[model samples]
Target: MHKINVHLLGHMSQCETQESSHDSKSKDFRQSDSYSVNETNHTKAPISSTGGTNNKTVPQTSEQETEKRIIRRSPWIDTSSSESNSIHHVVPIKTSDTCPKENTEESIIADLPLPDLPPEPPTELSDSFKELPPINYGQSNSSLGGIGDCNAYNAINSKKRSLEDNETEIKVSRDTWNTKNMRSLEPPRSKKRIHLIAAVKAVKSIKPIRTTLRYDEAITYNKDIKEKEKYIEAYHKEVNQLLKMKTWDTDKYYDRKEIDPKRVINSMFIFNRKRDGTHKARFVARGDIQHPDTYDSGMQSNTVHHYALMTSLSLALDNNYYITQLDISSAYLYADIKEELYIRPPPHLGMNDKLIRLKKSLYGLKQSGANWYETIKSYLIKQCGMEEVRGWSCVFKNSQVTICLFVDDMVLFSKNLNSNKRIIDKLKMQYDTKIINLGESDEEIQYDILGLEIKYQRGKYMKLGMENSLTEKIPKLNVPLNPKGRKLSAPGQPGLYIDQQELELEEDDYKMKVHEMQKLIGLASYVGYKFRFDLLYYINTLAQHILFPSKQVLDMTYELIQFIWNTRDKQLIWHKSKPVKPTNKLVVISDASYGNQPYYKSQIGNIYLLNGKVIGGKSTKASLTCTSTTEAEIHAISESVPLLNNLSYLIQELDKKPITKGLLTDSKSTISIIISNNEEKFRNRFFGTKAMRLRDEVSGNHLHVCYIETKKNIADVMTKPLPIKTFKLLTNKWIH
Candidate 1:
């Protein structure tokens, strides 16, 4: 006879039943065993004999009895008590007598919550039972209360069906259930629960979305992150640069106990993308902290490299020199800070909590730019044998090269190529420069300076235009005015009401609205100056009402901006040619609209031309009122002579020789008074005095005034509003 041995864990309790050999008045042997355990628990099934009585009895075929059983474990009972944690005895499942049961009770344990077991049997299991199948009673969902008709039972019943199909049926024990097949046995109501399987599959099959974040503060669901190392590298680079310049010291402990938190300047990273798709990281010192004078008392940054005198430089060195541009990097970081300043160490730099004592000037400090300018200017004068031009401190000249800087961007002009190289090398030795137009010939160099494109075209014309990148962001218009090709209609009102300042929105909305209006007008004004001269009068007329802008003013501004966008592709030609009339002089045109504004003030329009090319112009409201067109024109001339007289000085400045300039206007009376010292003709007291200064500027300087036909006066475009045909006729030749 063969005896089968079984092992059970201490945490388990079992009541086993076995059949006696005689059924033959077959008797059942029953034993109840209980044990307590602290660790994981296990259980084993009733063993049958291999002798004649070892016959694998079929459960349903037996007339004696068939009992179906199941085990229910309560997972949420008090774990602190061993009695509560112990496994309860198996409970017989109540089913109809007609229901079939398994001869072996293996299916009963299929849904029990069993602890995990190792692949290799433990020491508690004897080698005698090595080939036996593992008694794995895995945990199933408790949602199926007592596992009456759930998927676990359905799977078990399916196994029984497969076994019953064979002639000599052998029960197959499977520990797992196929959810899809298990759900097939369910009624329609249970169908909704099966959607969980499909939902899981759907989720796993689909991929996550990738998003580009602004500053990492607003992303909801993103699968990718930007390269974090780039930001870290930028921060480290800045910190190292500052350290090398002795901008701070953390080696010795400073007294931070008495330091006021408000006195410490906060610093942050300003990330920028350049035109070439590279990154720029600047550490800015927040001077807005502390007082208005803090970090702002030293030097004035408003004295940035002079740009107004550029035309003089252009006229002096147009044909004689190679136009080159370069930018000095870290220009502000080179100078020393006058006052002892403390800054909170930027977190990205990975510095400790200790405050940083700044020794050198840093970016974002109000006076840093001015300090750097002084340092560079001193270096140029002392080391490079360069003379500083008092008119424009940014302009520096050596024996052969002339350099003009606006902030950090330096434009160099040298007649000799070797002289340029020498000057550039000298600058490079003293400062790090990004050579934008390095040894390139002026004819091939199209450099952008101060939003203006200074380019030599085809080795013939020195063209000054606008930077395309600067204006591309403005709103584009399909039509100059209304989209339907109709002229813009006014908003029922003229100007803003005087007391309208009292009307306000929420603080943020008001600021945003104002900024929107300002940005629209500001950029539109620039775009007009670049190529859209038609927008000049409108923008000028609209800008006056920006402070208390009404809906009407905004409506007009939008119309003008739309017009500018419509003609965005146009540009006035800036070229120098021997005058068609043999006059190596300027052509000045001044016009005015008398008492045209809502305040009854006159508008002055002035245009300056050199060698027949429009160099500069203005369309502005006159500071004082004018009674007549003559007075307005005369005042406009007075306002304009300062700028034109400066041009005369520029001409004489070029070669130390007298150069003549011409002024053209339709106001013959105003022109007559300006060219003469005749006080009798000056009707207005204000304009009379202005005319005397105008006469002195015309004669004292070599500027000449002449009268041109109104149709021929291009400056008429600046004076007042005109029809499209008249505007085109007057401005088409000079602009666009």
Candidate 2:
């Protein structure tokens, strides 16, 4: 008979090594007890020797010995048993000790808690449990929600799977967390419910939950919120009423009160009809009339597009400088028609069926835009000695300087300080020029016109801050930067009536409209500072006409004027006791938009200064007809490139720092075509040559082309009447 005794920690247990020992124990304990304990120990020794070494060297540290015993006993221990036979392997730190300790079956059995037992007669026991397999780490527990099905016994003994596989399984499980819960990860559609839940959850999650707000804070929040609501309510009401009152009679045709046939023929190259009664009938200019510069019997087209280019160029060049835009109140009234054409009398003013004779140019005349361009170009070039750019017909020249005219607006760029001042002063004398003098030169005004707002500081203008209060008034205009309003005036004002009143209107209707107009101007006036209106003056044939007099327009103008007035009062403060280094670079943006007619187009002209002066810029339509917007813009840019080259040369000649020039356009396709040297064929003979030439210029000039959003394109305003908001935004780029 044989017995095995083991001590693990403190508890002791005993198992019979031989069947004879188990049989004897099973018989009478009294008979087994008769056997000597020394005899049982001696009998067990032979069985232990048959298995492994009995000279077990126990570790001095109980923890270390326990781990060693578990590792050694792992194979023999039944992993399926209630007690887990797991071992945590620890890498031993490298050291220079060379003593190796022996591990034996007896040592494992001794380490296990076991009581001494008497040996009995031989009895056979099944050894099937010794063949149990080790388990992988992942298979260890179904209670832990493992992917593969695993029994408790196998799971307890399993070794862990590799890290990569473990992570994959974890990801799958986490991905399905929301689906398993049948609830969305995002908030539900009902925001109110979600908010309620969020509030409740927030309270629960707060480190130190606060169930109520302080009494004073609650009262203050309520009062403040109420006041804010009241202000918003008042603002909405006033704005809505004014907007509702703004109506125009688009169906009715309006006629001018006076008609001079000779002026009409000379300006429009069209005839007029006589009235049945007296000559009191108003004359309306025929927009489709032919002119020497615009329409011809052979070509049959007008050169208004040329004026658009000139306007854009001028505005772009004078962004930061004073831009005194002037309108010849009754521009055609000054030019008598040379030809004699006939037309029907005005529907409203005419008596019996009498036709009107020759007359002055009116608002709707087709050749009116061209005539205005011709008049201004002649004055600037012929009188001022300003030479026009050859390839681009939009440019004109003054002595040692150049003046670009876009109908009512003009931009002046000079070669030297003397020339620049001389040109500015001369133009001021010719037109009703209101020199803002916001900055050092005319280029500053062009920059501001390109959507930069200018603020005067110490005899110079700085770009106004975008966040100024004037920006708040932008959205009121019903038009984009290109004034696209069908109704120029509300129902009360009748006919194609142009208000040329120099005296301020006191009535609410007129005042309200003016206020609105001023809002746009105000917004445009802001650039790097608040807007000022003190310097704002009306430029019209009529001593009274402020072009933008509608409440919406006036509001915009007032704000802008105020911005200017306030800005002029300010002085620049340089805390650093050294002269600041100035950037010597030039930026120009050019773009174009097609008109209501497919053949007609508008152009955007822009230019920027690095060291605060006009470097280069031109916004103009293509001389030849373009098949697409891309082609037209490319032509404009091509024309601008040469101007820039000349400008750079001029700057160098002026003994100024070398300027790094840049060309910007809003058309991605045009930029791509120019950069990649892809030229589009134009069906129109006039535009085809220029289109190809433009592509060549863009490639040859090494022009730095960039794409800009329309909102930021300073040329936009030059091409069209901008809505108050867009106008205001664009105004900041050039006017400070």
Candidate 3:
């Protein structure tokens, strides 16, 4: 008998040891009990003996007994007879020989059939379970049962297929997730909305009149051979005109190398378009580059003051004087040049290689205006037998005609048409002059001069307006409404104000808007100074933000343009309803709005009225910050003294009698300060020098400071924004 020992193996241990023992003791265990254990659990099976063995019962050998004892000792195998009906019950087989030589362990094990086990219950998979990627189990090193190995290989292959299918599904889902993420990362496209208004169209319609053009630009701007020929002819005509006036010594042409380059002045062309569409060209010297030492102190020239013009207009309206406008042709060329200067010949004149020596004053010499002033002044005083006014060199008068000269533009006043004609004929004979208006009609005549349209009704009234100027500069608005179907309201008076935050804008956009605003404000300023007294305050306010502008400023400028366009037809009229007073009256209404500017500075507004007709005005921000309204008023009064003196002198000279000059204000405290004799009281205030000046003027009787109610003060329109009703009322009072 052989002793046998059974050892239990864990699940992970290989079955190679069991196979080796089975092969080595194949003969010894031929007649032993037949039972086996699988990798997962124990199973029982019954095996029959070989065919040659006898069916008779034989005595059990020690080996067989040992095997039986081992089987009984194994806890995994069920040996109870009462559990014979169980699926796992092992049935003992009867054999004749204890040790059979004919049969081997492999043959015995191969002959047994595996018991049927219930299929594993379908596994319940969790939601988090993921199928792993397929893994290749190439081969096994264990020498276990062939059937078990084959079955394990097949099961792995089935699981691998399942994992492969799950991996494919995960790849598809991942691609879908990535696609969704990509869409969210993309940017969306949107359309920008455009804002439009009538004022915008009006601004776009303004085309600045070209005053100076280069030779090439002139040719390019004309765009046609006839137009080009016209400019070319005008160029030749200007040169010829200069030659006839003996402006330059044409016979002594000097070589460029022979003259000092610094002494030689460069020349350019100045182009102008007449109302009749005639193009006029003038060859002007670049006198701005000339050194100041090249000329004497006579370079300064003075033109007629605006107050003089106003007085003349008032006198004409009162006395029914014949009025005429004359334009002096080539006035600057008629004078003689003092310094020895040379100029490069203009292009297309066939003298490019030569420089013309200037003999008489050319159009652009540093002293040309003074030379012309001297020549015209001498002509009027010496030749025309007219006496020059005492304080005004540009104004000349005689028993018959009085003339006012503003550069080349001249206005003539006379008691009859013959007297005006006599002066016009003398001017034409001495110098080439154009009679802009002859004053030949007894009813009414319209004259345009210095951007002002004057409509005079004999012995009735004189209406001054800028309808033509506005129309020529800014055309009418014929554009459609906004595309969004929103109708913009008509702009009324200028808004309350603009702040610093609203002026912050992008650099490029701010520059463009500022340029547009400059143009609009320039036109407004011209209108305001000449005729439209209502726009002075608005223009002054808009001028503060020209350098740093935003969308709000631009919109406000557009509104101002719209308002001016709507009131273009309005005018300032001087009526002759009553007989002229024995002596003229010069009245100035001055007001101030304290702490209204962005930096808390004050604004001052001044209106000069001669016999109740507007002559001149000023609206500007004060240079110094004022502490109180009285200080601001004192500053304004001081500033207006010069204007008042000028008006007073002009009126006295024109009427040949003493005139009264009065300054009206809405601040009673300011009037009291002006009339106060105790100057030390306000010496410590902010109005130091200004207060002193105001006291001196009031004490000397140079300015009469009076107080009026706020509602009655027309200068209120110049210092602050007013309601529509008040604005219109004041506007009508100042400008009829």
Query: Tens digit of lDDT per residue, candidate 3, span 82-120?
Result: 222222221112122132324322222221111222333
Q: Over the stretch 250-362, how does candidate 2's per-residue lDDT look in tens digits? A: 23322433443333332111121112111111224444443444332342212223323322332233332233333222343333333444344332333323444534334
Tens-digit per-residue lDDT, 1-736, candidate 1:
1111222111111111122111100111010011112112323322211101112121222232232232232111111212221122221222222212342122222211122222332223233333323223442111100000122212221211122322122111111112212323333331111111121122211122121223232122323345454544655676777777677766753455656665567776665445544555667787656455455564666342322344543453334456677888777777887876778776654555667787777787777778887888889888888876555556667657677777778877766677767777888887887788764554545766666665664335655555465444553321123334433211111111112112223333334434545676667666666545545666665555454333434454555555554454455555445322322445567766554443345667877765455666788778886555556667787788777766665444443433455555555455445544445665556656776777766666545455443444566556554434444555656556
Once superposed on the true structure, which residue ranges of model 1 sit more than 4 Å away at CA? 1-233, 250-257, 260-263, 289-298, 302-313, 316-320, 349-353, 470-472, 475-511, 528-534, 579-584, 654-657, 675-678
Better of 1 and 2 by lDDT: 1
Find the 10 residues in a row with the least total lDDT in model 2: 487-496
Q: lDDT of model 1 at residue 101?
A: 39
How far off is model 2, as Cα RMSD? 35.0
In order, the Cα lDDT scores of the candidates are 0.48, 0.34, 0.58
Q: Estimate each model's TM-score.
A: 0.62, 0.30, 0.67
Best by lDDT: 3
lDDT-based ranking, best first?
Answer: 3, 1, 2
Between candidates 1 and 2, the one scoring higher on TM-score is 1
Candidate 2 regions exceeding 4 Å error are: 1-283, 286-327, 336-339, 344-352, 391-394, 410-459, 464-584, 587-659, 662-699, 702-736
TM-score of 1: 0.62
